[model samples]
Target: MNKPMFGIDFGTTNTRIAFYDGETVELVKIRNPDSGVDVANIPTQAGFDEKNGNWHFGFDAEGFKQPKDSMKWMLLRDYPVEEISGTESKELVTLFFHHLKAVVAEARADEYEGQELSHAVLSIPVTFSLEERRALCESVEAAGIVVEQIYYEPVSALYAALRENFRQMPIDENLSGRIAVFDWGGGTLDIAIATIRNGFLYILKRDTLLRGGKDFDQIIVEKAMQDLKSKYNRHLDSYIETAYHQKAADLKKTAERIKISLQNRDNFALNYPRFIPKGAVNPPVEEDINLNFPVLKENLRNWIGKDIEQGIELLKECICQTGIPLDDIGLATRCIILAGGTSNLSLIEERLLEEFGTLKFGPLEKIERVPPIETYSSEPRRFFSSDKFGREDDASVATAVGNALLAADGGIPTFTCDIGLIVLSPTGQPYPKRIFQEGSPLPIDKPIIRQLPIINRGQEVISIQIYFQSIGYIKGEFEIHVDVKEHTVEISFHVDRYRILRVSGTGKNYPKRTQQSQDAIMDFPIAFRLPEKLKT
Candidate 1:
């Protein structure tokens, strides 16, 4: 009980931390005051030189020409790591914690005056695999922070989200009702839809995509390079290639400002010489910088409009997939909770308003179109930066902080293993059986019994194959060896996120098992509502 608990939220672009002062959670955005990370815009870009094994980070790191390693970005939640490589191997909970420690120590000496770090809670994405979740726990342990708990990113965002933004809006469950999550951020564009459940908190039902606002920024950066090449009219194919690094950085900065402005204004006036986030200086000639003053709200909208519309449609498709009626959701929908950095876009809000916009805007046809602006609306949609959190960093840091909360709960711990044995052919031959699946949830163990009708003193020992699902069918028997003793046999399977699984067994004389019984055999980590294909 004497343990001091703190919340650490490490976001993609920024990091925000807080401590539960035995009461209210205070913002602890302090970096390692002694380290370069203490300065804003520095930690995410830090790099390590392998040759000399040197560490480099901070604002300067952001401006580097080489591909730098991001310590903070290493803790990405919701990844299906089985498909990843490199740092992916470090996805273990222990390894993740190690990275956190470096970040903390960097910040502590820089921010907390080198105080001893203690307990912490963390957050992660809504649908991380059990293994990924386990890795999150490992990160906390690696950080040496006594983990208190772990929670879903969205769930934690809900806990500390800025509420004033969408607390009063009309909500709907049927995606057709159109609640757009225009999440356009640095790494991913995570979009989801909301349906009012009963005038209460907006209950989300479907996701659109993971792409974020950063993609658009990246898109514009590409355009800028192309335009620069066109202007220089270089004969070399690598034309403007050398300028790409600094120019792209400059473009992203301009894009952010333009992006921010497009929400509420008709146009974004790009000044000739803008300061880039990475500190690449670009003093463009008036013609070169070309005041694309009004990237015309419509022009910018058209650029990313398809993505927004697809996002909306994705929600609709998911809602329809849920098999719920549109009216059922609309009428029963309650309040909506819009939490995320990209949700702040005006184009998104304006497009959304056309669908759910109040009569205060007047006339459905005039204010709303079928695809509502079947195109991009003008720039400058009214924005409400949810007042739920006081600090500016609160919005961006909430998800990361929420992930820390998850770490503290001991909620993300488990071992995994694969069970031995397999399904057999009818002729007393062995069929390898797998019992556990990778990334399966916690404390999930299962039992399967097959009775083989045997005559008295039937000497034929029944061999029961225990195995797990593979690309389609059950995988081969475990690489280990086991013996059969009876014709009537029973098998059990067990598993967790960490150990994967451990398979051992006692069995009865089992043979001539029915196809039906074989089909219903349960899998370890048995709790999931498995897909039909995996149910077997």
Candidate 2:
């Protein structure tokens, strides 16, 4: 039997997996081993148990009393060691994949029928650097799963939306029109502007912010702390300091619950016992907190309103960067599609509708004062009824769904390099060379070759420095020694599907003296950077 392919969306807060089984794409439900209770998604948490020198992941790590760290967004960036819960980032990521693989095996035991998990398409953030992408691939590979392709989360979400809404709209018009995907998930907010042409998704511009639902939860926590101080005239920071883990965890959970509840109802009153340090207060304090709807809305707006405006501005900037007229953007854009968990927030929808004019809420009819798509084509009406993925008010899994769809579609995942490559002279000064121009499609099958002629005799070493125009730094340097018989050195550069650059070459020798043979290879994993024109 052929191995089943899977799509894994590794998210900051939750991870979702999906697979296509010839008929339809279905999400895998991971059941807790002990409880046998199926969970919609697995929490992205892991811990290193020092006592056993073992690693725990997901729900297993939750049982550990020791400090557990979430290395979702932190793993993608250069984070300080002290901030990472005293565990190595790479180890935590590997542990996460190890547990994830076990869950997938159990969830799809019947479908796999004793076959090992072979192929998978992984979804990553648009802003992921090349190093981060390579790290993710290595971690997955270490867990015994083969990563077939790496896809952008927003692009995957767009694919899912296209599948859900394609038949209802005019194919030609929708394909030609601009589509903006606003993905506001747990850890980050990403906005991508693109158009579909000839059945291919063409991304024109994309922007990402390190802000999302978690930020809103933090805002609520801060407000709750302020409220407690105002009501009882006692700061809870001291109490939190006494039991940092438990108290902070309780506060964050309470805040998140209240925030989600506020979506359906106007207000919610949360009554819970306040944490009091022993001997700090004579009497125990019980807190009664009444969270008002208007206050929550106002606070949310205050916290993220500028972020929404920035997203809109980024969309405009992208259009400009693509050389499209401002007036034409409105006519070309079909609708602003919102995805991810944070997209459910009413405040986000209101802000997006105000800025973008036409917003697609995806079955969120309870959004007060917002208009829905009134008219529909004579296609299958059931498909347009709700969030077509069978999930209610949850667009968080859209990336996983779309990734599965794309994996089934069977195409090579492609990306464009934003920076142009240049080589430097022996004087240490950089000289521009368009080895690969900016906005060039990657996984270039053809290798770019450059030959350097030996200028001086007795030159022991020849140094060549490479620089990326967009990043404004030396990518790396290659050193070649000059033999008395060598005349010219040829360097060849090739980029693979994973954005890993390979450099190899041979040296040409002068006639008369026995030709000095040279064979060397250098590998560089290129990082992603914003386009030079787009950088501010």
Could you give candidate 2's per-residue lDDT for residues 104-215 as a string of tens digits?
7777646554544556888888888767888888878877777876778887887766665552333342245566788888788887888755434567677788777767
TM-score of 1: 0.58
- Supply the TM-score for candidate 2: 0.74
lDDT (C-alpha) at residue 465 in model 2: 57
Top-lDDT candidate index: 2
TM-score of each: 0.58, 0.74
Which ranges in model 2 have alpha carbons more than 4 Å from their true place?
1-3, 31-39, 47-55, 63-69, 76-86, 109-116, 167-174, 235-237, 240-245, 269-274, 277-299, 358-388, 414-485, 504-536
lDDT of each: 0.43, 0.60
